[model samples]
Target: MPNMLLGAFPIGTKSGANNSTSNNKNGKCKFLLLCGGYILFLILGAAMFSAIEAPKIDAISKRVQSFRKQFLQSNACLNDEDLEEFLKAVITANDRGISPLRNATNEMNWSFGQAFFFSSTVITTIGYGRVTPLSQTGKIFCIIYAAIGIPLTLVLLSAMVERLLVPARWLLGTFNSKLGHLYQPFNIRLLHLSAIVFIVITLFFAIPTAVFAYIEPTWGALDAFYYCFISLTTIGLGDYIPGDGVSVDNRSMYKIFISGYLICGLIAMMFMLTIFYDIPQLNLGQLFTESTNGETEKLHLSSNNTTCYSGPSGLYMPQRDEDTRRAIVRIRPHGDDSPSPDEAPSSLNSGIRVP
Candidate 1:
């Protein structure tokens, strides 16, 4: 009779054990494929970027070499030794406002206006490095300033982003009201993200690129766009800066205005990134985590009871009241009629007992 009962109730095998294993394997495969596809996309992007930029870089190099050859040939007085001496003089003259030539007015570097711009850049973590603090005292002050400034800047930007999210959420809600019935939530999210991206590109990138190209004679539209991208991304490659190559009458004011532009652009970028990360479907961080049985875990809450599940998946699954009660009853002692204070209420209608 015991053998028959044992045979009737299976002990080792589960109902959906094979299906669960298969789903996990499929999820892992999908994750790997997603990763591989992303890697390939990056590789292709890099290749295309190199293909477009390489010729321009090569042309610039050739022009530089040609200019150097002509300069050396044209100047009968400047031999290799004289060139070395001239470069040394130029280096020494840097930040000192002294001209390497016989008679020239000192460049107004480290002026109050320029210093203010530099401080703004440092606080924003832009650090273009085109103009840097040279003196020991200045360096020490910069260290102290940045130590205090970085966090303050972050707090300010975060507050600004939080405020901006009101309009952003309004736009999302509008999109949902118009299209939610027709499309999935993920599609609506993408549409919202695309709209934000459009706004950012139009305001920060396209208009700025046009303005920069118009103001800076040496910078074409592409160069201006590249500069904007680098600066907004905080890459600060320092290869291209505004109001630096040209001799503008109000250089200090130009620097101050550009500083304001950088700050605004950074704020817009931060807001866009915050919105992007809020969408779970697009978050890349999930790739590194373990996969579950093909279903994404969702949370459910009740007024009186709470239950959670855990496994290799690192996902949170909700349990029904009946399931919760059964689990608790199965685990508790057979004679124990009442649950302990730590135990969650069996049903949403039941009141949670206090100790």
Candidate 2:
């Protein structure tokens, strides 16, 4: 009788297990259906948005093409008299402070250096208006080229700034040590940064601004300041340009000077950013977001614990997360195969697996 009861227990447990499995399967199906519905809704919304925006984009494109056609029409290649008239119109526009609608062109075969400078100016958003890309192919290429070139310029600027900060970091430490007793670390660092800013402004900003204001036939202090602000911000509106201020014999020298100004001003800005980072409060911009906060904590841990922290005094390293490491291991099975570099060993598993 006892053996029969034991057999009945197995049947009872099997029934319970099957019921639980059916319940779980139903739950999963419901969840999957809900997820699929949400995704479909999102896709529909995006399609609607694109459909609405399409006409506006098409209209703008059509207008641009129409203007391009007018500009590139063979009549645009004017004789000397016509050219003179055109230039005078441009100059007159400058004098009267009236900007005519710009048209496209269909002329290529510019000097390599000219093309390079033009590309740089456009990518930097400076649009100096000294030279512009001509030709339908050139304009199309210009759009694509600027897309890539601007990002490249940003990366180059970032790298240059990183390199420049080496000295700035040392200077910060020196100042901190000197003023440790008298001021907080943040205050001392700010003082050090101010000194650097004073030097940079004296040479790069104030001096250049004054000189440009005095020489530029039409530029006042406000115009000069605006130019400085615009250029430094990389707005490159091509409206208020530097060379337009003066009629110099040596255009090459003027361009070289402007290039130097750009480089120095960028370096100064990076120095200011270094000081900004020294303040723990403002520096939190990188770590303030929910996603980045996790990244920040990981960085803090790694920097505090590892040799990466000791490389330089002011080099900021982030903390690492064991939770993320474990999550990766859970997703990938580690039964027989070696784990990937990113995957951590689970506590339940004994062997140290390598990928």
| Best candidate, lDDT | 1
Model 1 clashing-pair count: 0
Pairs clashing in candidate 1?
none
For 206-271, candidate 2 gives per-residue lDDT tens digits of 888898898677889888878887777667666676553334334444555676677567657766
Error of 2 at 101 (Å): 19
The lDDT per prediction is: 0.75, 0.61
**Residue-wise C-alpha lDDT for candidate 1, range 1-355, written one tens digit per residue:** 1111010112233534665677688777988888899999999999999999999999999997898789999997788788878778898665344445544434456766677778888999988887877779989999999999999999999999999999999999999999999999999999999999999999999999999999887899999999999999998988887866534557678878888999999999999999999999888766545456224332223233544433445333346655554333223334445654445566323333211
Give the per-residue Cα lDDT of candidate 1 at 131: 80
Model 1 CA deviation exceeding 4 Å by range: 1-79, 91-107, 290-355
Candidate 2 has an lDDT of: 0.61
Runs off by more than 4 Å, candidate 2 = 1-117, 128-131, 284-292, 295-355
